[model samples]
Target: MYVARDCYEQGVKDYNSSTNPWLSSPLNFTVSSTQNKFVVVGCDTYAYLSGYQQNESYTTGCASRCESTRFMVNGSCTGVGCCEVDIPKGLKNVTLESRSFQNHTIVENFNPCGYAFISKQDTFNFSIDSLRTLRDQQMMPMVLDWAIGNETCNDVENKSNYICGGNSSCQNSEDGSGYRCKCKDGYDGNPYLSHGCQDIDECQDPSNCNCPGQECINEPGKFTCFCIKGYHLDQSAGVCVPNQSSLQVKLLVGLGTSFGTLFLITISLVLFNAIKKRSETKLKKLFFKKNGGLLLQQQISSNENNVQNITLFNSKELEKATDYFSENRIVGKGGQEADRSLSIYFLHSMEENHLLDILDDRVKKEGDKEEVIIVANLAKRCLHLNGRKRPTMREVAIELQGIRKTSDGQQNYEELQFSRSEEIEHSDVSFTSTGSFSIIASTSSSTVLPLLPFKTI
Candidate 1:
């Protein structure tokens, strides 16, 4: 049951009266329960009640007030002075309204207001002060229905509609309809136990059991167990203990061996890395000296004026930078070298075809290709059989330097003429007439060249 307390705490008064109309009965009823019906007492104010319901919508149940000949002597809403009405059966909610005849012009001085409600009868008692008093001294009690299941326990048990399981029973609902389920007596489990009820084991039950120095065993539908006179079950350990050791010495030995092997492998790796690094350093020094390291350094130091920038790189550095000398990094090496070698054969063939022109023109034309025939002419000129005609190493060096500077965009006619003059001064040996240069002994017994006339034939 539910009780609505504030339905009509204050009395409902007439609109024209000094009391507030908003506090009147009709507004109170609408504010209270929406489903419950109310009865207005103490005056046959039908028109006022009708207007109140019309304002609140008459579709809601109406209120009935007492006749005017019988005034509210006491606070009770009886037939003579108070009023009462039977609330609807399925009443869930309600509201109240109050109105006066002649707009309260007839009885406004004595009966300025009236009361209406659907309240419990015992809580409110009628009093004479209600006629002239401006307030209400009572609260309204309302009844609300509370139900259990929408289905009965019997219906649920028959159709297996309930969820409670394991040692339980169903009971009829206390309310008008439906039912509830609970565990059965002597069983501590769910009701609606269609799945099967589990029996309580009194021997294993903590509250009733006295298994001193014995084991309590739980059975499916019962329980019973006891330790013998000499033995007691260990409840804390949940198992029987035997006084025996179960360990192998070999296990410890194998674990130690595994650790030792791992340590040796780590040491071996460290020593191998150190040795490899030392070997690489020694190899780099060896290659550097073999590849004319000392000679290149001494040449550069002796000829500071002719020195050019030369960079020496370590093999490891080049290999690493070029991804270990990958094939893609080998530019102009394989096919290019083979093509150049073939071109030399082609030049030799052209030389055989026009030997005189190749010699006189100082340039060979081979298959519409302009080729320099300088190397053959220089070899012929340098390898004369007479001692006085071969070109000096100094003259060769100067001419080569002049040619290189000309390629570098340095156009010096004077330097070119000077290089040519030096070559001519030393060009005494004629290779076509003599097979080699003749060595001349000087006064100091050292080989030297005398100043000779520059001639070309």
Candidate 2:
């Protein structure tokens, strides 16, 4: 029971339990002292717990006082900051009220409110912060003793109104009123209802298995543990052990274990190789798609006139020819600067009979210088800014073949034939295949040069 008072306003409140109905049922309801305790929390607080037992009145109280918060220890209810007292046995109803010496005016800034309650002992732990605020919660849980009626267990054993069901037993309450029902061993659940008690299967719970590596046999309300086949209980080791048998059986077991290990290792190696091959195939496909291989193939197929001798060098071949793109192998500045410089250098090198320096030295120098100059000039013309000023690569290829025929016994390199002159309608051009250009001719209305590094002049 709680005593109501205006804690937010200044006043002297009277304490009384006359309005509480709990006092009228003292014989049937007893306050549980073991389950609950009286508690009061505040800096300048005092609380009282008064009750009646067997027509006699009993009064007890506790005073909690603290000058500062330094004397408080959290989770403890001593007389310094918070206080707790155990209720007396056989006390049925109790009333709780808070009192202060000076209306908490001395420590009003830190603790203006006080709280008093009879709550479950296990659930109430004092905290120093509660002195400052209570968060609008004014009540706590309390336990009350309950029984069927005023009767001993033996007196109600054979009565027609006895509520204890099958598989249940009755025990006289400690308060001397009635009896409480409880299920028997190996059973659980509410005992007051018909068929409420149910058998417990210990073997069904994995954690209940006291015997490891053994067969657990379940029975009605009980279970048994036994060793598995081919094993016997080793009492000293407290575990199952294999039966001591002939040496031939042991030899076969060892052989089987060795075979299993080898089989696992073989499977692991096969899977490793399979994963590696799959990754490599996936990487090759990615590289091909990224380099526009399909687009190149489509262009080559469209050139029905002269697609012969067209070659697409793989990465390994091009890397070798360019000396792996080492700094020394680069002829000029990279990008557009290099593109322009390479075209000029190619023409100059050919006119000066130094063409072998740009091309592979492996090429035969037996070719005529006049034929080389004619082909070089045509490539240089393709570098024109205006396409109309430049002869298309097709026209250049036509002239290049005529010059090659004049130098008839020279070795010829395989070359790529362009689809149309429109493909070369830009100022920039790069023909890199095996790091050297090749010559090929096609009879088309458009002009384009094959195998030579060229730009529209």
Candidate 3:
């Protein structure tokens, strides 16, 4: 029999025919005696085979038997002091029993039983109280079973009803009787159950794996990488970044082009409007100066100095009075039409030959109309000749009012005559070598002389 060194320190006793019981000694020894020996101490005991024995011997010890208070069940040494052991190689069977010292009465208060058996080391720890009754034990009995095959996982998988799923491989158990399943690479989880192995997405976690500048697409048990837009990945850095300054320059150029187009449009529009407004103002000024505005002002100033009642009409007022210079309001007789048309021409010529000639002709043709003749002749003489010689139109107008106050039965003739006196004057003279005259007149001094030689009617 073999025992642990620690078990021998607990006072196991040894006995043999040649050993001396009188000498006190430690009970640790590999018994090599020629005869079988028994080791008994308190309630614990053991039997060892003699030297060189191929099989061990077993026998009963003293008759101090202890009551059986434990039993083994289901290969577990769990009930009381009784236990099971792994039998050694080539071993058949062994018998076990209980023993007690003092007939189990001296130490019955603590330990009422003892047991003996052989077991694998560390399988059982004996109670100290059991040593009190160790002497009564005879032999312990145990059984062992053995098996004979060393099959691998492949051999077991060849059998029907194998549990390994698809995408899985089997591995032999270390004991060599059974097998276990594992999923293929890129998969995880239990392979024995249906749909147990799952595909691993490498793109989900940023660490351990990387797509970097590319798109990481997970497929069945694998992944794919593709570069992003606007940047090519540098294999060294394994990431995508912006393109070079050339791209930035191109963007700036496009932006500047767009702004330049808009700015040109704005400037063109401003210039167009400015030019159009300037042209309009220039045309208006041209019309104002060309339409005798300066001449009109000069005439008005001269008339004012002479105390004449001359009113200067604005162009709009004159346009309204003449109905926009309509043809119907134009006054003349045949060739004299244009001379009487415009007021500026009429003013300059009214004090010349035209008014006097008209007055003389009227006086001569109407003798019974003496008062009318007198008023017309006076008005004619007042406004006659050049600027220095002519009387102010104010003076002429005052004399006419005096005649109107003094006239009686001649009022009708005077009224008709007064209206004609203020009519616009026009000359029909044509300059010639002989001084051609459309309307000729004789001066006061010349009226006393005879008619001229080449004079016509």
Candidate 4:
């Protein structure tokens, strides 16, 4: 830090008027605004101080005026005789000018010379007697701002010239240039030297732990408190104790534990039900897709005009109809019987037409025998082992339609026999057949079998 000081004394012949100029070493020094002020003391004294900051020149001053010493107030410089003003920040140089407004003719007998100086604020108190006897004083104390350089905290932290020591942190200067050092939290002392900052033992302070008889453990930067076994803090008393016979405490603890156990059980049950419901839903979806539900929906959609409604059987209904999809409920072999009653009805209708046995009593003599024979033959062809030999559903529909137009039912039966050369004797079609009847399809490599046969009366 650098300070510039000068004084104006009485009887200095060559120095009647004084102008003190303070110049800094470029950016190294500045007049501290926090610690210094511009001051003037004596009757009819005019003082002006000028400085340059950030390339802009500025000036300020104070004037002291009084006719007699009786008008001056001791320890007060409110412009009656002595006056002062604060200095601006970042002032690199300053010039002080002192002048007399009245030529000192009125007060020179009592006050010979006026004094002006820049010094620490509030350091000087005006004395009414000093107006005539202050010529012997040489200099006044002032403060200046100083730092190592213009580098910031971050710029110095990684460099060899960093000044902050261990347990310390760097702080950028308030002027936005240079930096300073200070001890870190939980530590104190000089931060510019090695191992200067030391830890503070917070356990020494009894106020840190509210629990009387609790052990206070001091850590690196903090402290903790713990009670002995079976003892707890009584918050109202701010101390540790064991209340072994309090009914209210026992009741509170019991209620808390009961509520906690009930809460855990409730949560467990809720989670278990959620997981079970999700698993069941997922399994149902998988079964729906596997049982060709999508294909059935597509087919029903395509023929929506002919099929006015599509009914979907849920898992439970299907399970009941197919006897849980067990082999015991299926006729003719291992494939599922989706609707056991519907399958039985289909086979019974075929038997009523004399497809499996003698013709039904109602259709025995009056019904068209040739048409019945034609349908029975077609039904038998559907049970063919080779899929290529079976007629497609479209072809079967066309054949049934042609039977309606035929004058002779035998003609349609012979046409079906000519269309497919597969044999269908009496033994080939029977109600007592046990295994599944494989279909014959010309276009499909995979053969699906019919799983039902019926009883005839």
Candidate 5:
């Protein structure tokens, strides 16, 4: 490293610049001038540079002139506002001085003083503001060329004082006054001491090779690339690529496709079930409207609290509502009844012991007399006026199966149920002007059970 003693009294004129010449180092080299430039900064001044290189003296100077800043460029140091000259090589001691051509009488308003220094050419640039101040800069940097005592490489290569280390070589200095040592190619370090040069591990940087899939092998001061298993280097692409035509790759692709297909099927089934449930709800609503259930619902909701719309119809009223057994209303073209004016008649047949009378002769054959009486008693309990007295479903099934013995006559009882199922579908319903609802259920050919509830359509 080389540093010039650079300083300037901002508003003063008398100053001098010089570098330490008596300094010594392990390599025994002095300050170098080969890498420095003699720089002069002023508008109407001249700067001189004097130095000694290997006992040889030299003197050089450059003059700068600029009237106004209008045409001055900042970085151009070509005799405008700034000027520079290459320093002589092998210079060990330097002195810089400056003098104003007209005592700064013309450009003093813009450039009050002049300056001269030794520095790297790139380290200094002239700007308009530099004329006013330098931001208190005191030191500037330059490059130094180092070498051993005054001797050529051949004069000391084989002597006991030779200093070139392993993997290094000795070379004469640029000024031809001394010699220097350097590490050879593929090696680097201080080359003046024993074992100072070391091999460079190029593999530390993988970019030494263009292939990433290949393994980087580090050799002494060098590197090589080798492909790993399941990979091969492609000459055209200049890179290692994995084998795509392998069974493992095919297996992965097949598994991905199968899972995707199953996901789609599961989604389709979920959508199908949602549509089916929505359609069922819509159908039930349509059937309810067609059966006058909407009007029945409105009548029930509009009634005062503790009010009900259900009305029971007697056997005579049910027969009238069915149009006295007209064939067209039963098994032919369906007709809507318009003559609907009915009086409520809740049946109390069990209290009157009229059980056998409600059974239709067309529906029931001559079954056992004992079974008939047993059935009549069950009906009385199921039809109890107080709902709390009514037998539960479990008790009803137990009583029917326990009280009666199994007989071939059971076939006749089943026949009676099947024959009346068709007649019970459209038994009879009547609505009065007061919005009273009456329904009669035909359990047999002639059996009429009043106020029988049915499930929603």
Candidate 6:
């Protein structure tokens, strides 16, 4: 390196050395550009490096200067006393030339010469001692990069001539001019030779299986540690640990018992509620039939099309409507419909010749007297003691229609006749003294001592 700087006072630029790595036959290698640098070290020295490249020539240069050694740090290359330029990749050759100013005219006693060269980056140390002692060492070490063939890995990867043997992978040279071969993971050897790569017995190495006092078993490309009975491998720690099967079984049992108990309680509550509701519904239906609810429903159904839509209220509905039969709501049998109704009172009044007295004051004042008497007498026939003597709803309707047809004439109700007819529909007229109901339903009703108690619900 000193040869390039051994020159005149002003500047002398010439090639003082040449270095190349490919000259070593059978294993041609290139200087590792990534691992080495073109370095220049001196005060009042400027230098550059030149080399051949694939696309063009490559050149790099650097400069360093320091008035006194005290200003330069021992190992720092900050241009105070040392400078460096990076080597370009794929540089097969390195040449150094230099320019010297003052030529160490002042520091010539101790720092006699300037130095420039391509040295391995890791091995070079720039100390103050290096400035005076570097020349004593004539040779320097550098790293080199190597590969297998001139063709890239991709170009010959599948070809028969591919040099990578078994268990080896091909790698392209960093410079893009060739390729290299390396053993596959877990195998190591010269990958360029057939069967050169061999499996590494990791079990033999103590660091591979860190399970102390345990047997280590080797397998293809890897190893495992054998655990004793009632133990399992702790994957994270790579050690044998006691199994927790007993604890896990206890936990599962506890969870199952709790869930089953809660589930049974829930099912029992639901079943109790469902059975209670069903039994109440069945009892309600039984009482309804016992009270002759069937005949009431049939009568309603038969009359429904000919009159307004009808609604039948259950016991609960009726109780709610009258505020559970509060004493304040009681007026007469008409208002207290729990059992007897106005029909009973009306029949009693008619039998005693007190039909007119039972009529509402407003009805007596506004109604035609003849119609009142006719309707009252009809009601008397309807409440007849013999069920067979009672007129059908159709016959009742016919007689009522006949009364309406003859309303304008001076009616003679004293001679009114009773006759049965087959073809007359019932006429609905004011029956209830108050409320929206057309009529009241009674399961047991009669004023006259009857042949039987009729269920008229």
Each model's lDDT comes to 0.47, 0.68, 0.46, 0.68, 0.64, 0.66
Question: 303-392, model 5: which lDDT tens digit per residue?
Answer: 744347477565589789888767546421235343111100113444455545666685357765555666666665565557678777
Q: Worst ten-residue run, lDDT, model 4? A: 435-444
Q: Tens-digit lDDT track for model 3 on 136-174?
A: 433322222222233557676777767777667877543
Error of 2 at 196 (Å): 0.4
Error of 5 at 415 (Å): 33
In terms of TM-score, the best-performing candidate is: 2
Locate the minimum summed-lDDT window of 10 residues in model 3. Answer: 17-26
Candidate 1, 210-282: lDDT as tens digits = 5444566776655666664444557795433322221234566688899999999999999999999999888
Q: What would the per-residue lDDT of candidate 4 be over residues 245-345, giving only the tens digit for each residue?
A: 55468788999999999999999999999999999999978987997977777779798535546687877999999989887654433354555544455
Question: Which wins on TM-score, candidate 2 or candidate 4?
Answer: 2
**Residue pairs in candidate 4 whose N, alpha carbon or C atoms collide under 3 angstroms:** 332-434, 332-435, 332-436, 333-436, 387-440, 387-441, 390-440
* 82-146 per-residue lDDT for model 6 (tens digits): 88878777766556776567766766655556777778887787888876575555556667777
For candidate 3, the TM-score is 0.24
Stronger candidate by TM-score (3 vs 6): 6
Considering summed lDDT, which 10 consecutive residues are worst modelled in model 1? 435-444
Stretch of 10 with least lDDT, candidate 6: 416-425
| Model 5 poorest ten-residue lDDT run | 338-347
lDDT winner, 2 or 5: 2
Q: Which stretches of candidate 1 lie over 4 Å from their true place?
A: 1-39, 44-78, 132-139, 152-154, 157-457
Error in Å for residue 416 of model 4: 99
User: Which of the two, 1 or 4, has more lDDT?
Assistant: 4
